[model samples]
Target: MESNVSELVERLGSDEDAVRKMAVFKLQGSIGDPSFADIFIAEGGLARLRYLTLHASGNTLAYSLTSFARLLEVDKGWDIIDQEVIQRVVELIVTHPLVNILRGAMSILVSIVSHPYTGNNLSQGKDFGFPALKPAVAVYPQFLEMLVNRLSSADHALCANALQLINSLMRESIANESDMQWPKFIQKLQDLGVIRAVYSLMQETALQDHMHPLIEFQSLTKVLLRKWRGIPLDLENPEHRRALKGIHLASLHERRSQDICIGTGTGTPNSKKHNPMKWRRLGFETESPIMQFEHTGFLGMMDLADYVRNHQDEFQKMLLEQSGKSGHQCCPIARASLSVTLILYEHFEVDKSEMDDSKSYLLLESRSNLDKLFEPLILHWTRLHIAGLHAFFRLWKATGAESEDYERIVELVRILIESVVGGAVRTKDVQEVEEEMASFEYSRLRGLQMELLELTYEDVWGQHLMQMREELYHEALQFIKEQRIRCLLQGAWFPSETSLNLGLGYEKVSWTYAQLSHNRRYLHFGGFDAIKKGRPELDALPEKIDLSLVSSVVSNVSASNDPLLPNEKDIPPASYTKITIHGHLYPVSTTGDTQKNDGQNGTLSKSAQEVVLLSLHPPSPSVASEWLDGLLMLLNQQPITAKTNKLLNLVSNYGLKIRLLNVRFNDVAFTAEAPPVPPRDDLDNDYYYDVFGGT
Candidate 1:
């Protein structure tokens, strides 16, 4: 371990920046291991790392800080980080010019502030002990103020990092809401201009094609929404009250005046002139009353009806242009506009108790717009996100049964839920194959007549095709409810979809898991062989090699999860697992299995399988283990034979298989009289045959 620490320290001093970054990254992961941590500190490796954090240049400096933060993540690891190092990290945040370095510094500060030191009773005393964590609390107010100021940085990345740090700090405060101190902490954040900064970020990036800023903007706004929901608005404090009402004050005052005019069918009296004010127009214009009089908030939240009223032409033009844009089917702008239209239609009120006899021209027009958006939005349904769906649900519940498009919208939603996923085998590929092989029909005479008629018609007639709808609103509602519960449990709001195929040559076939059977050559996904009707193993692999494999599944090491940076060879469209059959490796691609039935056409459809053989690169470690297990089970379940015993012993000797009830130590252990090695010539011949598919 000391030798390893020395090697790492030498790498950090090397001329190659990448080598130095890798050295720091490896040190971070090793810090969790007590042995490695002890060796690092004992060899003065920790002191070397501290010097690098303060003096290193470029990527090396960023990496050093990141590793330093990870070192402090472990419990009692705080003892290793002193007040000077903590102050240095804060200084980096305040003074670093490079975005990457600032991001690293921000990460380290976030770790320091977020560390759980409240309950620990260390050797120093009963209440607090760790000086590195203790000083952070004292300086937090100043540190947070600095971050809030950084929110206006010219660099988008720097601003985003600062926002992320503030968000993390806010999340902790929200989590400890039971403590009354959290409310004051939240108010202090507001006072520091955090909310305004978030709003400015959103407004700036609302229409950009870049996704990172938009994602960051959404995260910051979400934190504000949580604060709005958790704590009541402090109307007593003038600044706090103004901050809460700032975004919608003009609209709120207008709505209040409109409410008075709508109530008596006349405007309030003009007191200065001592004359009664006359009403201009009723609530039943082409705009809905909800859109006209919504008071609390509008910028961050969805208020489609109101938006359309304010900028009707621009909004409609945006929708039309985005819907027609080529490339991605779910155009962001188009989907957002359509989703808002649906929301407005779902919430429009035709008859309120206050306006029992009033005409609902506004609602009637809104429902008509809904009729247009419902079909178009469904055509690009994949573009809509879960948040949009939640908005739709809220609007539906608010509308109740009064909407003219209520039944129609419900039917459309049911069709969307069923048709978006699965139902049956798509015979389209098979049909195309058949069509090419079969004889062509005689359309020569009809084609000529149609050609002449087309010339006379001046334009080709076209029709929009849509999936047939079913009245399964109740089922769709139940599904939405279940999704809500799932979101609550998982803390993940987006629904995962099956990934597209990567087109892996001949191995592009979709493979599924089949049930273990007594007689089957190939274990197909259907649980039974349609042709062979017998269990079968891979012919490509040697029979002896197949018998020695074990099977286990694990998550693929994604770029983020991987300790080292990714290279060109490491990138792929899908996750993979690798299995070692004998000594040869094979890769298997894996993903979630999504199956559903199309209620409209009454068809059962299935896409690709959850697991498939890649036959390209090495599979993930988990896939390799699973394959090994399956191979072992296949051999163990067979009738006892010399070949089976030899294969099992080979695998067991390698420590690949789990120990069975009976100990076969004599068989599994390596002995002096092992199998004789093959000659070089024979080994070369076998390798050539395996590569070229020879006997």
Candidate 2:
């Protein structure tokens, strides 16, 4: 264990910056004392963060820094700080070379303030001060004043995070000020122009966006103003109250205001459409909402081949990014991966009937092209990322959803796959390590292959496609347009058809994405395989590894009451065990609810909590009523025919009443519940989720 620890420490100190970046980012997943990992950012620690700010070329830097800024400071146990670096970071917040890094830094600062460690003594905010202070104030009063002022900088992009931090700090500071701290904390706040600073800043941002932070800040402002009346503050007003509410906090009120915000089409200047769906339904039965997509520009058959020809490194980087985007989809890199399987599928075995007529399609195996692709592929895997894959996948499918166009996706996935990932197969050249467990584990492979594909397809198009059925093939076309997935569609392999070739109950599609993200072999399984098909015995692994790690993972997974590789057709165990994630609670859904058919659609939807988040979090009824109404409708609907109904009742039925609860784990599709139809409506479902806690 000591040797392994030393190796980890050394890996944190790897000379290769890429290695160092990965170490820093992956450190967030450390199983041990996460606080210990922060020491790496110290003087003796890895200073890779410095390079990330300047080197914006490689997206690895952007991801690492962004991840660090997001997760690190939130860990209250991790109180590590380098004031000098922080000073630089704050200074660079507005002028950073990279927009992402700046956003990340701001997020980290907010997370830091959110931790329990925040206080007047240990922290600083708007400096309203009688210098005659007590030792309890660890942070100087003036520092607090500066922070408060900075927080209210009025530049939404600039001061949003700082503003939030200051607001929380003020809330705590005002409520907690005493003789033990600065003398007259409240009086000092009044004296130090806190109202002026905040009000001025609010005016500046009033004309801009509500990135949700505005609502939070407004609440804090209201709290402060209520205490200090005659400050030109009145929450009694609807706008004032509405602005104080979070996007989802207080749904009903928000809806009324949201309705006002969305005018009742008066024609000329003001009579306009808010959501495209309104115009869509009014315009045509299948008309779509206006959508803005970030296209990568590689479209059509020629564009597909040309994209393959020129941007091999870029493509591979994308694959690597996607392969490990979420913990669930982290697969093993083997000799034969998705690309290899694609080749095999094309050469050795071709399902002619599945092929669609295309203008031009051919195999791509030129040594030069592969060689160029190899460099990016290597670079991508070396870092392990996701931002790049979305870009790459979009580019690869820029043409029609032709099977031939998706050849690259299939090939690369096939080539890197370790073994029977999802249902796809891949082999590692293991002459020397035949008796050793050297390759990446199945958990990793299955997590990426089965999980993500299942998730992406299902969430993006599957549920709506299945429920709406053949009549909705045009809907698929619409979704493709709205989602812009059609722009990336490969015409031959996975092209747009006017029909559903396979029977896709919501469950299969959800699981397929789950399989793709993690279990790569899912494609080969055909969704019809029975459970408990064949439990592979614990055999000699391909590498000498820690058995305890494997044991811990299995224990954790089983502890959730998730099945232990059950037969394909077997009903999963009804687990009394409940797991929580991100404050979202997940209880096992019983078969009665899991299989319940709601509506004529036969769609199984999410539970009440899934439908109504405002039950725990007051609905921001003022922000948008349509989202709330849609949610309420989904919530009220019984498990008679809808996907969400079955899902909600599956956990714990509420006698057809709407009751929403919050849990640490919001993604419950994998929690031993029979997976329902894919959540096509992003508002209602999920195909898969990144398992956060377990390593």
Candidate 3:
């Protein structure tokens, strides 16, 4: 097979076009196999293919591009492709006249820039070996502009391809904000007028007729607008100043005034000059109302908030109509449009006084749309439910305490919360419920609930609502805690350390299941077989440690310095966590026999002060770090406050570390030096309180 792949590679240098084309096709077929791919690349197949893409014409050109696309589909194939090759491909996409050639070129670009994996792997606390590649085509100066221009293409397929390519580039750029290229890439997209183009395309009757592409464009445009949303208006920049002026003008146009006739006590006409005397009149007097209007002048210069506001009715009608559509066919488009609407509402600063007059309209429309979302049938879809939840929060915040519909909004929120948590609790008996809880849908729901709780805690009305439904609120919190723990336990395998004296004659190393007891006061561990057989009894376990007796939990140890347990190469050093327990020791037999002797029984012994070190190896560093934080929480005996629970939940959900700074509660404080805490969307900026600090 290697010889066959090598022979085809050598044929790429043939003088006959037909022979080279056939060789490229054959190589494309063979490159799917990693071994064959290595042989082809070793024979300089990449360089040969690049040459054909640039110099060859017609069938050879198209075939070579298709082959490159196929090669990129292989695992880690982007590592072998160079930036120069990516640039040439972009050039072909721009200059090539053939649609097939253009399609093939776009496919290669998509393969290069798309995320390497699917779903929220990072949120799940898992790591992929391959980092997502940056959108190399952004380096080509005209590629983004070309893509924007292609949005108006007569060919639907070409336009769809352009949207996909643009979406992939934007997604990759946004996902890796640390990359220096993101700002420049975003500015380039904005400068090309991509957002306006997308909005215009969305309004087109033709595009709206096709559901999939319209949703894609809507989602892409929403992402593009994110960087510009809520950005402080720079009065120094003429464009920003103009945007402000346009907003003022639009407000004036929407404003209304009325004059009322009033009877005067004196029968005399009022003078227009100052210090005029009032006159009494038996009849009524008429007065002219002041009115003002100005030209908005070039909608392109206006900010997105004002732009959406200018067409508020049109956008509202469109979104409301789209939200009304039912079935799987329309769910995605509805979700995308709702997300876009959410961003617009957020930017509109709906909580401020300026939006007070329009609050009724916003609330009424949001409530009506939410009626569809809260339906028993529609609530089953998690994505749609999330969108509805977000929209509900925004409307609830905007409505404040003044609207007549405030109570109704509160009722809808309760329903949404119950719908999310109750559904999960009811599914606990299902076989796949554990897997379902670990899914991205539930993770997103959990994060949303945390944000809701925080919002409720801060607002006066929200506080009242919480008091009214305190039980439901606590249930929501418990649901979050359980789901977080479940996610942490997924794929977590702790191997017992060899150095510990388990009364076994020989060193024993095996996988064990570790979990918090039913009341969460004790940590228990038993053989993996018991857990696999669906019986994980805490009291029946051979080894149980009271969390209150735990002194400290240390991780990332290469070797144990304790004189009692010698350092050994029984487990990987990076994943090891050394747990120090004081006061009592519970030693269990390492043998597989289930018979419990008095010494091996899971019982607390009344012994003198003793320090025992137990080392465990988790699946990864993040998991080890999570276990460390959880144990520290237990050791401190700190009650789980809303803030602390949120922090722990963040650690479990996003795999971030909680660096306990100064934590103060009831005039007591605990401080620790650790790495800087990662920024979270839900945290307040006034002070970065330690998550371990009890509220």
In order of appearance, the predictions have TM-scores of 0.31, 0.23, 0.34
- Local accuracy of candidate 1 as per-residue lDDT tens digits, 173-255: 65564654655676687788866666455444222321233343343334443344333334465644454344222322233
Per-residue CA lDDT of candidate 2, range 188-281, in tens? 7646665445444433414234223443444444343333322222346453334323211221221321121123222232333443323211
The number of clashing residue pairs in model 2 is 140
Q: Best candidate per TM-score, number?
A: 3
Clashing pairs in 3: 264-281, 265-280, 266-279, 266-280, 266-281, 267-280
In order, candidate lDDTs are 0.42, 0.33, 0.49
Worst 10 residues of 1 by lDDT: 490-499
Residue-level error in angstroms, candidate 3, position 123:
28
What does the lDDT read for residue 162 in candidate 2? 58
Model 3 Cα lDDT, one tens digit per residue, 519-578: 666667666531255545556667777765555565443243323234555533333345
Better of 1 and 3 by TM-score: 3
- lDDT for 187 (candidate 3): 63
Better of 1 and 2 by lDDT: 1
Ranking by TM-score: 3, 1, 2
Model 3, position 631: C-alpha lDDT score: 58
